[model samples]
Target chain A: MCQLLGMNCATPTDINFSFRGFSQRAGITSDHSDGFGIAFFEDKACRLFVDNQSAVESPIADFIRDYPIKSRNVIAHIRKATQGKINLENSHPFVRELWGRQWIFAHNGDLHQFNPTLTGRFQPVGDTDSELAFCYLLDQLAQRFRQGHPTLQQIFDVLKEIAPKIAEHGTFNFFLSNGQALFSYATTKLHWIVREYPFKHARLIDLDMDIDFSTVTTSEDRVAVITTEPLTNNEIWQAFAPGEMILFKDGKILQQVLTTVQRLEMEKKDPSLVRKTKADPD
Target chain B: MCQLLGMNCATPTDINFSFRGFSQRAGITSDHSDGFGIAFFEDKACRLFVDNQSAVESPIADFIRDYPIKSRNVIAHIRKATQGKINLENSHPFVRELWGRQWIFAHNGDLHQFNPTLTGRFQPVGDTDSELAFCYLLDQLAQRFRQGHPTLQQIFDVLKEIAPKIAEHGTFNFFLSNGQALFSYATTKLHWIVREYPFKHARLIDLDMDIDFSTVTTSEDRVAVITTEPLTNNEIWQAFAPGEMILFKDGKILQQVLTTVQRLEMEKKDPSLVRKTKADPD
Candidate 1:
C-alpha cells in the first residue's frame, strides 16, 4: 500500500515545494518509508526520477528536493510494498508509450491472478499487476476504437463500459494522463478538488505549512489536485464513490460518470437531484 | 529511495497482474511496505488507486489482487519515508492540474531545509519536498510563459536550468507527464529503457512470471520505462548519470541534455572524445 499525489493546473507550476514536505511520510516523520519517486510534466512531456533507497536516506532523493523542474501536470509516489520484491525495477509511477504520445502512470493496489491476454500494440515491461493492467486497458482501447482515436465523450463511454469489468476482479482505483487531460477513478477510496478563482490558503495535513492561493493564481487560472487521501487538513476533498470515473481537462472536470449505484445512493439521501444547495444558490 | 512504473500505449493494458507480484517488496517479500498507490490513464486523464495500508494486508490491496482494468498509462509507488508524516497525506504518486492537463508525480529522496514559495497559481496540497519542487517548477513556467505556452524544447531547456538548482539542496530524481511524452532526469540513481519492436521474452526477478513481448507489441509501438532499479532480471536498463535529462516520446529518447559539469565529466571518462578514433571501432 502507498500514498499518491497529483496536480493539474490552468497554468504551469512546480511541485518541488509540495514534494519537499510530502516525501517525509515514507519512513522519516512517519513510517510508510520504503522508497519514493516523482514525475514532472513540461508541455507534452515529463521528467521522471526515482529511488529505491528510501527517500529518507537516498542522496538522489535529496537532489530531487532542490531540483525545480516545473510542469503543468505531475504525479508522485512513496511506497510500502505489500507483494512484490524490493528491487529497483519494481518501483511506482511506471511509464510506457502508445500512439504518438508518451504516457505516464502509477499504481497502489495488489491484484491476485490478474493475468489477461493483451492483444494490442502495447505491452508490459515489468512483472507487476499494475503494468499488466495498464497494458490490458490500452489493448482494450485499441480494440474498442481500432481506427482514429475517438472524442473524449466517446472515449468516456468506453471507459465506463470497461472500468467495471476490471473492478469486478478487485480494487481498481487509479489515475491516468496523456498530456491533454487527466482521468480519475475509484472503486473504494479516492478524492479530488479544484482551486480556481479566489484561491485560498491551504494547509498541509502531513506538515504544518500553509499557502495562500490568491497570491499565486489569477482569475483565468484554475487548478485541480487528486489523491488517494486528502493532502490538506483543511480542504474539502470530495471522495470518489465506488466505481466512479471522472475526466479532467483545463484544470476542471470535463466529464463525470458515476456508477448507477452511486446515483442511486444520492437518490436515497436526496429524493430530488438537489443534493446540497449551496449557502447561496446560483 | 523508491521505484516507479508507468505505461502509455495506443491501447489499454491491465496492471493488476504485474502489481500483484511487485508489491511484495514493500515489507512482505521485501521491506518497502510503508504505503502504496497507482494511477491509470484512459484518455487525456486517469484513475488513481491508493492505500495507506500495506499492500499485502489491506483488504483494498487484496481486492486489487484480482482486478484487471486496462489503461494507456499508469504510475505506482512503494514508500520508504523521508519527510512528511506517514498517515496518508504524504503518500506518493501526487497529482495536480496545469494548463488544463492532468499530471502525476512520485519521489524517492530527502532534502534538507528545501522549501520554495508557491504563488497563488499552484500550491502543493501535500507535505513533501517532491511536491513542493513540483509546484515551484510549474510556478516558474507560468511566470516565464504567460502569453501562450512554451514548446517542448523551451520547457526542456527550463528543466535543465532548474534541475541543478534544486539538486543543490538534495538528491532530485522524478518522473512527470501531462500525457504526450515522458520526461526523465537523474542526478545519482535513475535508470530507464525503451521497449519497442523486436521485443523479447522477459522474466521477473522477484516473481514467477514471464511474458513474450514480441507476441504483444507491433513495430509501431514503443515504450520507455524508468525506475530506481530494474524490474525484470533480463531487461537492458540504461543508467542515467548525475545531472542528465532525457525526453522520451513513443517509447524512445527524443532529446537529451546534460549539465555542463556532467558533460565535462563524461568527456574525461571516455578517451574516444579526445582520441577522435577508437582502437576498436566496434
Candidate 2:
C-alpha cells in the first residue's frame, strides 16, 4: 500500500504546509517508504521529481519541504512497493504527455490481474501495475478523442465510465491531473478538504506543527487537498464513499459521481460494511 | 543562443564538477540565464528538473549542484530564450516518451521560420522552435518505425537524414538522448571530451575549482562530456565540425557522420571560412 496527496488551487499555491505533514508517512510516522515522487504543474508543463530513497531521507525531498513552489495543480505519492522492484523508474507519480498536455497520475491501492491491452500510444517504462493502469487510461482517452483536445467535461465523463470498470479488479484509488484539473477516484479509502476564504488555524495530525492560513493567504486563495488520510486534525475532512470519483477544479468540486450506489445501499441495509477510519492502518 | 551539457558514461557518474562550472555560466560568468533544466536518465526513465529562475539563484539548481545524482546519460541546458518566453514550459532539455523509452533533447541555437507539420501523434506543449523540432523528429521516428522499437543505428540514420534539413532553417546545434546512447549534432558550436583511465587533474575555466579525477574514479569508469564550450582548461576538448553528428554510447563514440561533407570540402578550399573558437561568444 502507498499514500497519495493532491492539491488543486484557485490560484497558484504552494504545498509545503500540507506536504511537510504528508511526507512524514514515508518513514517517520508510518512505513510507506519504498520511494516517493511529486509533480508540480506550471500550466501545461510540470516539474517532476522522483527518487527511490525514502522521502524522509532523500535530499530532494528535503529541498522540496524547504522550497515553496507555487502551482495550481500538484500530485505526490509515497510508495511501499507492492508489485514493482524498488527503483527510480517505479517511483510515483508517473507522467505522460497526451494531447499536447502533460498528465500526472499516482496510485495508492493494489490491483489484482489488472493488465489491459495497449495500442502503443502510451506505454509504461517501469514494470508497475500503477504505471500500466495509467497508460491504459491515457490510451482509452486517446482512442475516444482522436482529433483535437477533449473538453474537461468530456474527459470527466469518460473517467466516470472507466473508473468503476478498473475498480472491479480490486482497490483503485488514484489521483490524476492534467494541469487544468484534478480527478480523484477511490474504491476503498480517500478523503478531501477545501480551504477557502475565512481560513482558520489548523494543526497537523501526523506531526506537531500548525499553520494559520489566514495570515499567509489572500481572500481569493482557495485550495482543495485530497489524500488517503487527512493531514490536519481540526479541519473537517470528508471521506469518499466506497466507490466514488470526484473532479476538482479551481479549488472546488466541479463534478462527482457515485459509481457504486448499489454497494452504498447494501451498506445502508447491513451495518457491518467495514468502513476504514483514519485511525486504521492503511 | 543557449548552452548545452551532456554526459554519457560506461558507469553511473555524477555531474557535480561539470555542473558547478556550467551553472556558473547561467548568471555569474556569462548570461545565458533565462532558465535552466537538466535530465538524469536511469534506464528508460529520467528525472527532469526545470526552473524558470536563473540557475545561479534557483534553489533546485543549488540542490542539484550539492547532491550527486549519478546517471549514465544526462542532458542539461541553460537557456537564453531567443524564440520563446522565459518559463518552465519553454525551458530546454525537453522530454517525451517514444516507443516506451524516454527521449531527452536540448537545443542551443535559434531556428527561423521552422514550422513543420505534426501528425498529432506527438505535439509540443511549449511554444518554441526547438520543441517543435523535437516533436517533428519524434513524429518522423514514430512514422518510420510504427510497429516496435528501432535500433540505435536506425534512429541515428534517421537523425542524420533529418538534422541537416532542420539546420537548413537556421543554426540547430542540439543534444539528444534516449537512455541507451547520446546523439549530438552541431551546426555552429559544440565540443566534447572523453575521459578514461589514467585521468589527470582538471581545472574549470568558469570557476576557480579543480578536481583530481584519478583519485575519485575507478579504472572501469569512462565518461564522455558534451557541452557548448569547453569546461576544463587542462582537458583536451574536440570541437565538432560545422555539420557533424556523433553517437556516443558506453563513454565512447559509436558512430560519427559528417552530414555536409561538401561544405567541409569548400571550407578546406577557402581558408577565409570562419569558424567559432573557444574564446568566441556563443
Candidate 3:
C-alpha cells in the first residue's frame, strides 16, 4: 500500500510543516520506500516534483522540506509499488492538463482488475494502475463535458456518478484537484482535519516538531488536511466511512456523498431504502 | 527575446555544470529574468520544474544547480517576456502528454499575432504565443497521425512542414523533445556543439567556472549541447543558419533541413531552383 497527503487552504499556505512529518513514512518511520511525489497548485498553475527514490533520501524532497512553496491546493504520495515497476514514471501525484487547467491526482490503494477503455485524448504516460485510473476519469470527464469546463457542482455530480464505477474494481482511495477544489474519495482508510481561525499549537506524530499556528497564520486563514494517517496527534482527524467522497474548496467541505460502494450495498438489501441525501451534508 | 538551453546525451547526464553558467544569464550575466524553467527526461517520464521567479533568485533553481538529477534529454529556458506575463502558467519548458509520452517544449523568441485554431484535445493552459504554437503543432500531429505515434523520421517530416507556417508569424527558435529525440529549429539565434570520446576542458563564459570533460566522461559517453548562445568560451559551437532545423538523438545529429523560410526565399529568386536536400548536408 501507499500513503497519501492532501491540503486545501483558504489562503496560500506552505506544507513544510506537514510534509516533514509525512515524508518520514517513505523510509524512516515506514517502508514505503519505492518512490514519492508532490504537487502544489498556485491558482491555475501547479508545480509537481516526483522522484523514484525514497522521499527520505531524495534531495528534491529535502529541498521541499526546507523551501516554503505557498499554494492553496496540494497533493502528495509515497508509493510502495503494488502494480507498476519502481521508476520515475510510476511515481505518484500524477498530473494532467484538462480544460485548460492542470489537474493533479494521487492514489493510495490497490485496484484489482481496473482496466477501463481509454480514449486517445488522455492516455497514461506511466504504466501504473493509479495513472490508468486517473486517465480514465479524465477521459470520462472530457466525454461528459464536450464543450468548455463545467461548474464545480457539475463536476462534482459527474464525479459522484463515475467514482462508484472505478471503486467497484477494488480499494480506490484518492485525492484529486484542479487548483480550484479538492475531491477525496475512499473505499477504505482515509482521514481529514480542518484547521480554522483559532488554530492551536500542534505536534507531529512521526517527528519531534511543533508549530504554533497562531504565530504563522491570520484569523482569515483556514486549512483542510487529508491523509492516510493523521500527521499530527493533537488535531481531531475524522476517518471516513467506506464509500465516502468529500469535496473541499477554500479549506471547507463544499459537498459530500456516499459513493457507489455504499450506495450499492444499501441497494442490494433494499433498492428503495438507499438515502438520496449526501453522506455528510453541509 | 529569451534564452534556450538543451542537452541530449547518449547516457544519462546531469546538467548542473552547464546549468550554473546558463542560469547566470537569467539575471547576473544578461537580463532575461522574467522567469525560468527546465525539463529533464528519463525514458518516457519527464520531470519539469518551472518558476515565475528568475533562475538567479529562485530557490528551485538553486536546488537544481546543486542536485544532480541525471537525464538523457533536457530543455531549459530563461524568459524575457516578449509576449506573455511573468507568471507560473506562462513559464517556459511547457509539457503535455501525447502518444503515452511526455512532450516538452521551450521557445526562445517572440511570435506576433500568432494565434492558430486549437482543437479541444490539446489546448494551451497558459496564455503565451509560444504555448499556442506548441499546442497547434501538437494538434496538427494528433490530426496527421490518428493512430499510434509515428517514427522519429515521420515526426521530423511533419514538423518540417508545419514549423515554417508558424515561423512565418515571427521569430520561432525552439527546442522540443519527447524523450526519444531532441528537435531544435532556429529562425534566429541557436547554436550546438557535440562533445565526444576525445572530450576536452571547457570554460564558462558567464561564470568563473571550468570543467575537464575528459575527467568526468567515459569513451562511450557523448553529449550534444544546444543553446541560444555559446555557454563556454573555448568550445567549437556551430551556429544554426536562418530557418534551419536539426534533429538530434544519441548525442548526434540524425537529420537536418532547410525550412520553408529558406526554401521560399530561394523560390522567390528562382522558381525552379529550390533544393530538396538538407541545409548542411554531410
Query: Highest DockQ among the candidates is held by which one?
Result: 2
The local distance difference test score of each candidate is: 0.65, 0.87, 0.87
lDDT (10s digit) by residue, model 2, range B162-239 = 999888666889998999999999999999999999888999999999999999999999999999999999989999
Is 1 or 3 the stronger prediction by TM-score?
3
True contacts kept of each: 0.00, 0.75, 0.71
Chain B of candidate 1 vs. true chain B, TM: 0.83
Model 1 chain B: weakest 10-residue lDDT segment is: B273-282
CA shift at B110, candidate 3, in angstroms? 1.2
| Residue B259 of model 3, lDDT score | 80
Question: How is the predicted docking of candidate 2 categorized under the CAPRI scheme?
Answer: medium
The 10-residue segment with the lowest total lDDT in model 2 chain A: A273-282
Candidates 1 and 3 compared by DockQ, better number: 3
Q: Per-residue lDDT for B95-203 in model 1, tens only?
A: 6644434567766565444555545344544456776677678778778876645777888888889877766655777766656666677778777766777878877
Candidate 1 stretches with Cα past 4 Å from truth are A260-282, B1-282
For model 2, the local distance difference test gives 0.87
Pairs in clash, predicted candidate 2: none
lDDT score, residue B263, model 3? 30
